[model samples]
Target: MAAAAPPHTDHKLGTPILDQPQLQAGGGTAAVTEKARTLDHISDNFSKYLKSAYDDVNKRYDLTTKEGLAKWLVTEQQASQDDVQFFKDGSFDDFIRYYMSGSASVMRPPPPLDDTYPISNYFISSSHNTYLTGNQLSSESSVDAYKNASVLLRGCRCVEVDVWDGEPPSSSSSEDEDETAAPKPKKEKKEKLGLRKRLELRFGRKGSPPPEDQSKPAAASSNQSPDQGADMRIEPWRSNVSTRAEPRVLHGYTLTKDITFRAVCATIRDYAFVTSDLPLIVSLEVHTCPEQQEIMVEIMREYWRGMLVDLPLDSSQNSEEIALPILRDLRKKILVKVKRAHKHPGAADAKPSTLQAPSGEPQRSSSVVSTSTSSSEELPDGTKKPPAPKAKISEALAKLGIYTGGYSFKSLDQPEAKIPTHIFSLSENTLMEVHETQPAALFKHNKHFFMRAYPKGLRLKSSNLNPSRFWRAGVQIVALNWQRWDGGMMQNEAMFAGTAGWVLKPEGYRSTSDEATQKTAIAHHNLDLSIEFLAGQDIPMPPEEDDPKDFKPYVKVELHVEKHEERNAQPIPGGGKSKGGEFKQKTETYRSQNPNFGGEIIKFEGIQGVTEELTFVRYVLSALSSSFSNCNR
Candidate 1:
């Protein structure tokens, strides 16, 4: 009411506030001082105004109440028009920076764990109950731990978080009711008396003396056959189940296959905010048969997701703080933490590169030096000092995963039979068909596949098609067959075949004399691709090779391992014959690499400066190639 009487005056600067003659006469310095004073007063007013505006808009636009945050995400730093407008409506131009480009706020403090919010209280107080917090009792000789309490903390309305809680589950003898007889109605039906069930299923008579001691008691008592091995140690309740994940009733066998793949998936969806781009990668690595790698696809897939999406952060979550142990690189994680700490709103984390004045030998200075410094010092050369590089906040992401510790992917023992049929595809060189015409890669599923194939790469072709006559057109495809052997059983091998490879010099195609002499490898790696055009069927390789006119399209078949029979078809004297079988492709000389830490595959995109790891990998590879060339000779 008091302000309404006077009609509040706007004191903001740059809005015609410098018209005062005192400020005008004193020149720019005086004007700036006047503007600063006005801004200070207006800042307080603007803060209040913005807070009110934000409160109103947040209630209206927060989509978590309806569609769920996981169901929506913009891949590749992009945003929709509706979102942009929602931001504008919130008056971001007046205040908000539209951080993470309308994605993440500048400062999102972690919810205080012990602060007793209803959710926090649930996670904390439930610990008092004998409910497990997801830790499989890694130590302790007991099948006696409790199940997790509501695993609901995973799908928190806020950013999903997961902590090792490293806290072990406890055992409470709080059975809902005895299976032998119901004294009263129970709260939950998951209770039972173990004795009655054992007597009914394991024994022919109730309360019968066990058969275990009856016949062997006298001999067994005298020849106590020593303690069972440490690993074979078992507990009464779960001695038959698995020693990992759950206590197995028997030492190597699984306890209850109750925890299924779908159950694991639901656990994630119900608890974590899994992005649409990923849920799980139902991958299969064809190793030997008996020990097929059969993990719930959900478990293996989340390692990467946890690497990028989930942070080991219950405290501060930033792109940098996610310590994806699966990624084995401490340095990479540190750099990421630094970047995330920098951009995080209100996150007062230490910056990794807090550039200190570089040792003071030769240094630069800010040209905005005060007049005080101008009069006091001058160099003998009489030139003004170069301006110092003022620190600017950049949105560049710092990734520190994969390059360290070497293994970019995990190799599991899985049978090809387990790999969904949709994931399999014929190699481009093998030339299988969709009605016998289209090239090999014409199908897809919801996962990703990468293949390096040479569709039409050869050393010679009919002069009509081979305009240059020196280089023929045909593709070289490398197929690495990986089969895992577990003890005596053999698992179906999953094939990682390249759909194509590069065209190389004619001599290298026939012999290993001049291998990989400058060629580009073409690889097709799309996750669920849609090849619209039909490449058609592959005609059989033409037998005649002497005349350039009779030359037919041929591909380089690279088998990591081939059978003796398959090897005969392409024994070209100096190398394997080109008719159909075992021949490795020429090595590529100038293949692109991620340029940081190196291996056959680039760790990350972009040409970063080379590091020591890249040098080591190159040296090792060079040595291997040298040995192979020597053997060929």
Candidate 2:
């Protein structure tokens, strides 16, 4: 039996691997003899940087020589014999240089974005619950635990944070004495109280008292029934707790210790524009009192003053009708996504509603300052929901959300009503249903306004929705839980790895013309994508019950596009087979760790050019269910 392959470590996650060298020959098939010039012709001069980057990875290889260059190009580029021959012949240098220097893995750079398009026409990498790293019920909330870095370094352009009134208590001493005897630490308590005061001044205060008997002893709250009294006597002693004095960031009802919004702002300021130079969106769920609301705005102005994209109060552009500035125009800018102010009834410019709440579901108000509480049955992910807001957002906070306004999304039933210019967010459950019911309408809406989709409340463990589905529907910001490192998260990373945070929308999805909105007619042409499987290096082992000894590895390539009917399909069968219009691939079996299929080809016949452009291919390796000999049969 052959030995199991060691895990591959050379290629890090989010790094691009050139599995196949894209070679284009001008007229003759013969390898060119002239030495390829350095990549000076390209508009973006990254040649010097590329050379240095390659050297950092491979200290032993000398890119100037044939022997060293040949080895590096073949391994790094996954170059075929023709490519290797061309390299040795000195004609492949420019192509090699381009691959090493370009941002996109596919030889050429993607087309420049159309600045004229609305913000919704660009795909944005986003995250949910930027505070938590575990299940909602018990996850710890911290600023340092892979928080801002995911947005700054990991291609995540949008982040979400739930803001609540008052500073979270630092220790048990602040609680009522009946709950604990320990005295409060003065330093910690002072700092928290100070922060709360500042925020109160910024947001207006309703000056309401704390809930009655909040610090009452648990024993007192219990009924005087003997059974309840007995249970309280047996329960362990705990510290009495009180309401906070300032606004803090926290997950829903989870008793995870909270951090102030100041920390969140600091994180954004320090890391903003560090990774990709694109506009970063902050989706704020504000539940703070009016004073704290003002504080939130004040802090934003103090810390993020220069970088914020403040909308002009008297600007003639109606946010509901106009596209905002392009991303390049908003570099280093923080675009705040908050709820638009309540519209007056019978207002002269009152537009028809462009959205419909799901059938039988109550219509939620568009106020960010106020929101309806979810019943236990409707609570997300089995985690306890937090109490309703204690106060509405202040006028100051509402004014701060001018440029990048936010709205709660319903359904696509109301086409006449239009969403505001800035943002609209929906839970994954709501989005998937909308896609199923009115995919075209959803796509059309996305072209005009930014749409964000986040995980459903039921994802208690912080699982994520498939971003591909959301992206296909033209949703700009498909937020995922960055804390969980699942396949969904990995794929999300893959999609944004080499490109900037924003990717242009597909042509058909970019315009709202009836012809573009209609289903595109597929062009038929025989196309062959031949892959030469030299070997898979350091493939990971199978899980338990799948014997490592019985492993028969093969590769599968899937084309993500509209599925074509099998009736129109034609496949070239096995001994290495090709299946057009279908995603599955077949290759002769190899039992060893480095299984070399020599040259296996996957072909696609009668596929349209539009399908080809929108196509994204995924490569996966798996063990054959049966023994190698049987699989070959």
Q: Which candidate leads the pack in lDDT? A: 2
Report lDDT per candidate. Answer: 0.20, 0.52
- Per-residue lDDT, model 2, residue 52, is 50
Q: lDDT tens digits, residues 1-633, model 2?
A: 001122342111111111210111110110110212122243222344444555564466665566766676567665533444333333335444445332223333235555565566677777788776455545567664323323444456787878876654566555575466665557766566543343333333323434546422354564455544322321121222244355688764554557888788887887666555677888888776554565577567767878876654335555455455655577677888776553445553766332221243222222334433223323433334434444455544654565566644545543223534656678766675666566666767776667788777666666666666567567778887766544445446445544556776666666444423324422333445655554444444443324556667887655444433211221213311121223546567667555656556666555443244334455556564311110000
Model 1 residue 458 lDDT score: 20
Best by TM-score: 2
TM-score of each: 0.17, 0.62
Which regions of candidate 1 are displaced past 4 Å?
Answer: 1-79, 84-96, 99-633
lDDT of 2 at 37: 14
Candidate 2: residue 244 lDDT (0-100): 33
Measured with C-alpha atoms, the lDDT of residue 26 in candidate 1 is: 9
Q: Backbone clashes per model, in order?
A: 59, 14
Candidate 1, residues 397-476, lDDT tens digits: the string is: 11221111111111111121122111121222332222123211121111112111111212111001111111111111
